[model samples]
Target: MSALRVNNLAISLDGFATGDGQSLEAPFGHAGERLHEWYVSTRFFHAQDGLPGGTLGVDNAFAEQHEQGFGAEIMGAGKFGPPNWQDDPDWKGWWGPNPPFHTPVFVVTHRPRPSIEMDGGTTYHFVDAAPSEVLEQARQAADGADVRLGGGPTVVREFLTAGLVDYMHVAQVPILLGRGVRLWDGLESLEDAFDIEVVSSPSGVTHLTFVAKPR
Candidate 1:
């Protein structure tokens, strides 16, 4: 079966997925970059960014595992770019020439826009439908491969609350953001609905995996 997974999703010690005031300059917000310090220092991330010879450890291993999975991806409007920028004709994406995603990416947006083809076989498909509709389209495009939930908390929260996600891997960072975009804010009964398994690495990053119980 094809699983819908969120891999290497970082969350603060206080359960915030992203910090406040997300913009082009501050993608993750104030202290949000601290959550991803482990990833940035990994060899896997370096290789993806066209660098070489990074630290080989638990962090690198986890990063490599995340980079390998997911044939297709689904991101929210905010995850792609600013909502207002969608109306502009010149704005393409935050990534200038080459994007990190090498597979087909379907972006959920209210506004309509033409498909954008980027380098490395990555094409962004703008979907004007609901989250379920976008997931259905993504499943079809994935073709037996897993669908990755790429997001800015809101998108992932929707999928989780809807009980559409098959598996989720969240990397709980050691830092505390205090206040920001939370990952489990909207879900009222998530703990009761799904079974969560916890795993810890040497780098103090905790991985939480959630799987829905059979109904």
Candidate 2:
């Protein structure tokens, strides 16, 4: 069976995963690049940006894992676009023509639309189904590989709430967003289900891995 995983999700010291007022103009919102400073300087990140070089450290090691095994992606409507994006017929998504996800992408949204096949191997299929339903579709699309739970906090929370997540890696940044979307909302005692290991990097961000224990 393919494992469901959340990779490289950054959170604030206060536990906010993403700031408020998400839009095309401010994808990371008021939090800006504060949460992603760690990975942004990694060689893995520079490679994604089509740059020549960047730091090769513990951060880079973790960053590389995000792209290693996943065969398909599942993300929230918020991660797809800003508010009212569904109304824009011309919106192709935040990643432009060639998205980083070079695989089938199942977008979780209330308003379904026709599938979009991007320049890369990415194909966006919008669905209004629950986590389990979408996972079923993505599992078939993954073709025996792992499934990535790409998120914008709200969506991650939903899947975590549904107990569908098998593994997760969260980078706890130093900054604190006083108010914003939180990943752990209503998920009390969630650690009870997983075995967590913490590793701090020289970049000042702490990496946390949550591996789901046998049920």
Candidate 3:
């Protein structure tokens, strides 16, 4: 079976994955790209934009890991778009024609929409299902490759509570989002099930890897 994983999920020092007031204008809300500034300067990010001269170090190496051995993705409705995006029939996604994800993406939402196929082999399938059901669908789409849990904190917490995640890599940024959607909510002593390893990067972000222990 392919693994299910989360990579580069940046949370603030206070454990907020995203700040409040999310909209088309501010996807990450008041957080304002602060969480991803570490990867934005990496060669991996620059390569995505067809650019050059990005720093190649710890952050870049970690950023590059996101592209390896993943065939499908599962994300929450919130991660798909801002609140009430379902109302807009024309809103494809935050990404343009050629999105970063080059696989079938299963979006969990209450109001499901018809699948939207985009350029670069990315297709969005909106459905209402539990984590295990969605994981099964994504696993089938993966076809032997791993499935990535592209999240917005709430989604990650759901999967964590269900114990569906095989591995996770969370980048802890040095900021305090006093009020927002938190990642660690309802998950107490989560470290008990997963063996964690921490690595600090020069960019001032610490990467924490959680590998599920044998049951």
> What overall lDDT goes with each candidate model?
0.83, 0.91, 0.93
Give a tens-digit lDDT track for model 3, residues 167-192: 99999999998878999999999999
Query: What is the per-residue lDDT of model 2 for residues 1-215, given as tens digits with 9 covering 90 to 100?
Result: 79999999999999998897777898878888889988889999999889988889878888998988889999999889988899998787999899999999999999889999998799999999989999999999999999999998999999998889999999999887998898888999999999999999888899999999898
RMSD of 1: 1.8
Per-residue lDDT tens digits for candidate 1, residues 169-198, read 788998889888899887887877679988
Provide C-alpha RMSD values for all models, in order: 1.8, 1.0, 0.8
Provide backbone clash counts, one per model: 0, 0, 0
- Residue 151 in candidate 3, Cα distance off native in Å: 0.3
Least accurate stretch of 10 residues (summed lDDT) in model 2?
20-29
Candidate 3 whole-model C-alpha lDDT, 0 to 1: 0.93
**Which ranking of candidates, highest TM-score first?**
3, 2, 1
Q: Of 2 and 3, which scores higher on TM-score?
A: 3
The TM-score of candidate 2 is 0.97
Model 3 spans > 4 angstroms off: none
Highest TM-score against the true fold, candidate: 3
Predicted model with the maximum lDDT: 3
Off by over 4 Å in 2: none
